[model samples]
Target: MGDKLSLPLKPFRSRGGVKAPHRKHTAECESVVMPPPSEVLICMSQHIGVPCKPVVKPGDEVKVGQIVGDNDAFLSVPMHSSVSGRVKKIETVTMPNGSKVQAVRIESDGQMTPFEGIKPPKIETRDDFIKAVRDSGVVGLGGAGFPVHVKIGVERDKVDTLIINAAECEPYITADNREALENSWGVVSGIKAVMELMEIDRAIIGIENNKPNAIKVLNEVCREANRDMHGNVCVLPLKARYPQGAEKVLIKVCTGRVVPEGKLPADVGCVVMNIASIAFVSSYLKTGMPLVTKRITVDGSAVNRPQNVIVPIGTRIKDIIEFCGGYKCRPEKIIFGGPMMGLALPDDEMPLLKQNNAVLAFSEKEAARLEPSDCIRCGRCAAACPMGLTPPLISGLVAKGDAEGLADNGIMVCMECGCCAFACPANRPIVQNMRMGKSIVRSAKKK
Candidate 1:
C-alpha cells in the first residue's frame, strides 16, 4: 500500500474536508409517520450489492415485511414489502443515474398489516445474531445502501471496535439526529447488542458537536445502560464538518485508524454502522419487522414545509412532498439526499429507496451552478480533498481519457464527497471529473 492508502499516525487527524451551511431547519421537528402511499414502486437494487430478483409476480398478495425480492448472491439481502398490498406489475425503471433496474409496484390496501409469520429470531449463538440482521433487511440508512448484515458478518477476531455514526454531517439532514433524540434507548441497546454478540470490547458513537441535544440524550441513555452493556461505550462529540459522517473519515477521526484502499473498516479492526441502521437492528431484534419504512428529512428552499417524516421505502417523491404541504414554489431541481454528495433526480415519480435519508427540492437560486471558469492553479480543491486527491490533475487525465494516468495519481481514492467542488474558487466541476476519472479507470481495469 502507498501513502494515500494509509492514515497519518502522528497527525491523529483525518485529512482535508469542507464545512458547509448547516441548514438544519427541521432539527428540532419531531418525525411524523406518513400514511401509506396509494402504491409503491419498490426497486430491487436498493443496496450497493447484487440486485435482488422479484420473487412475487404481478397480482400476488403481500403483507408488510413479506419478502418480495431475493437473490442467491452473498452480498445481496432480501427485500421486503413496505405495505400490505397486491403486486401490480414488475417493470424495469430507470434510476437517477439513468441505469435501468427491476422494480415491483404494489397497490396498497391501506391496511398497514404486518406479515403473519413475523416474530423475533432466536439469537443464542453468534450465527443466530447475524442471521437475524440479514433477515431484517437493514442497510446503511444514512445514505449509502451497503447491506447491514454484510458489514456485521465479518471475522470476529478481525474486529475489536464498533463505531456508530451519528454525525449527520450533511446540511438539512436531521433524520439521524432525531434517531438519537427520539430513541436514545434504541441507539444504546443497538450498540450493546452488536458489541455483545460480536464480542467487541470498544464502541464509539460519533456525533457532531452541533447536535448537543442528540449528544446529551445518547450519553444519558448510554450511561443508564452501562450496567447492561458488555463493553465500554463512548459518545464522542466530533467537530461539525461536512463528510464527518463518511465511514473512512469517521474511522480516522474516532479511532485514528486508516482504512487502506480497496479495504473496509473491518480490515482496520473496526466496524462502522450508520446511527439509523443500528437503531433498526435493535427494533427488528425486538419486533421482528424488517426494514420497510425509513425516516427522511423533507426540506429545501422549494419545500412548503420543512419537516422530518417516516415514509415507506417505496413511496414516491412527489407523494412525500405533498405530505409536507407540497412545494413553496416550482422546484428547479430535486435532490435525493443533501445539497452536497446527493444525486439529482430526473423525475420525482421514481420511488424512494432504502438509502435515501433526505428529499431536497431546490429553487433555481439554490440549485443553479455558477459557470465554471479555468483553474487558476489554486490548490483549494486539493487542500479540501479528504483523501488528499488532486481533482485538477484527475480532471485533466479524465479529459484525455488517460485511465492509467488517473489510476497512478490515486484518482480511485476520491470519495466523491464534493469537497473540491465546494472549495473551488473557479467553480470547476471537479467532483464530476473525479467521478469520470474513476469510471474511466474502472473501465480500463475491466478491459
Candidate 2:
C-alpha cells in the first residue's frame, strides 16, 4: 500500500543524521513580532520556478501593497512592496551565494497601506479559486517557495491524499510551529481550502512531538463543531529527527511513500503543504494578501537578543539584526535558514525572500572553523545520506575533479542536507564538494 512506501528502511548504523548545537531557546521562548524596516529590497527571483519581471522602473511612486513585479510564468508570483515608497532603483545586487541578481529597491514612506482590491477574490469554482491563488504568488513558506498553485494543480485522477507538514523538525526554525499554535483557525481553514481545491477526501497533518503545545492546539481546533474538519483531518505525531520536515522525508515518515526521485509528491498521489504555507493560503483566501512577507527566526550567539520577527519579503538583513538589539559580537558568518541546511551568506546584502525561513547569525567561535582533513575512508558521509546516495564516493570523485565519476554516483541528487559534513570526523566539506561536482556536471551538460 502507499502507506508502506512512506517508511524507509532504518539503517542499522545510520550516519546521515547529525546533532548540531540547537541554539533554539534564543528565539523559541519569544513570540514573533513585526519589525518594519526603513527600506525594502525585493528580489525579482524568490520562488523556485521563475523570477518576476519588474513592472515599475525607478522613481515610480507606489504604495505598500502595489505589485512591483509580475511574471507571465504560471509558476511565478508577483512581487509587492512591503512599505509605501518610491522605486529607488531596479538593479542587480549580491545575493546569499555572492551572485548578482535583479533587485527592486524601494525607499519607505513609513505607511503600510495595500493597494485597492487587496481584498480576496470572490471565487466560485475550484478552477477560479486555484487561478486566484496562483495569481496571488503564494509558495511554500517552509524554505522551498514552490508555487502554491502548482502543488495543488496535479491531475485530480492522480492525487488521493493531502499532507500538511507541521513537523518543525529543523533546529532553530520555529516559524511554522508558532504559526500553527497561534493561528490554528488559519491552519484549519487553509487545509480546507486546499482540500476543497483538490477535491481530496483525506488530509494528514504531521507535527513533531517536540511541539506538544502546537499539537494540542491543532487537535482542539479540529474537534470543534461545525468546522466540518474532524473525520478527514488526521494529525500525526512524528518521531523527532533532523530533516524530518523535508518534503520527501516527511512524506516517508507520515504516509510511508517515497516521493520518486526528480518527481513531485503528486507522483505518489499526494500533495504536501507547509503549515505556514497553509496559514498564508487561508489568509489569502480571505484577505487577498499576496506572498509579500513571512515570519522568520533571528537566532544565534552573535545576536544579543534573538527572537522571531514577522518580516516583509524584501527587508534587509541589517534591519533584522538591528531589531534584535543588533549583534553582541561581530557575526563572522550569517546564514539564511538553519545552520544545518541553510546557505551561508557571502554578505548581508541579499534581501529576505519567500524561501528564507531563518536568519542565523553565528559568532566566529560558534561557526565551524575546522580545516578539511584527509578522509579516513570511514564511510560516515555515506551512512548519513538521506537519499541513499554514496556521498563519500562522490566527495572523493570531486576531490580529484572527476565530474563524470561524481555524476555516475548520482551526486546531483544530493540535497546538500549537510549530514555528511556534520558527521565527518575529518571535518571535510563533503557537501561543498558535492555542490561543486553538481555545478561542473551542469556546465558540462550545457556544452
Candidate topping TM-score:
1
lDDT of 2 by residue, 1-447 (tens): 244223222311222455544445733454656656788998888887778889999999887668899888877877887777789999987766666668889988777777775887888877887788787777887887888888887776578777898877678887777787778999988888877777876777887777888888888887672257446776777666666777787777766777766788889888889888888888888888787778888888898878778888888888888888898998999999987888888877678888788898899998869888787988877777777778767766776877788777887777778877888899987777888999988887888
TM-score of each: 0.96, 0.92
Best by lDDT: 1
Query: Which residue segments of model 2 deviate by more than 4 Å?
Result: 1-16, 26-30, 225-227, 399-408, 443-447
Per candidate, the number of residue pairs that clash is 0, 7
Error of 2 at 438 (Å): 2.5
Worst 10 residues of 2 by lDDT: 4-13
For residues 365-445, write the lDDT of model 1, one tens digit per residue: 998879989999799999998898888777788889998899899987788899999999999988778888888999999
Q: What is the Å distance of residue 79 in model 2 from its true position? A: 0.7
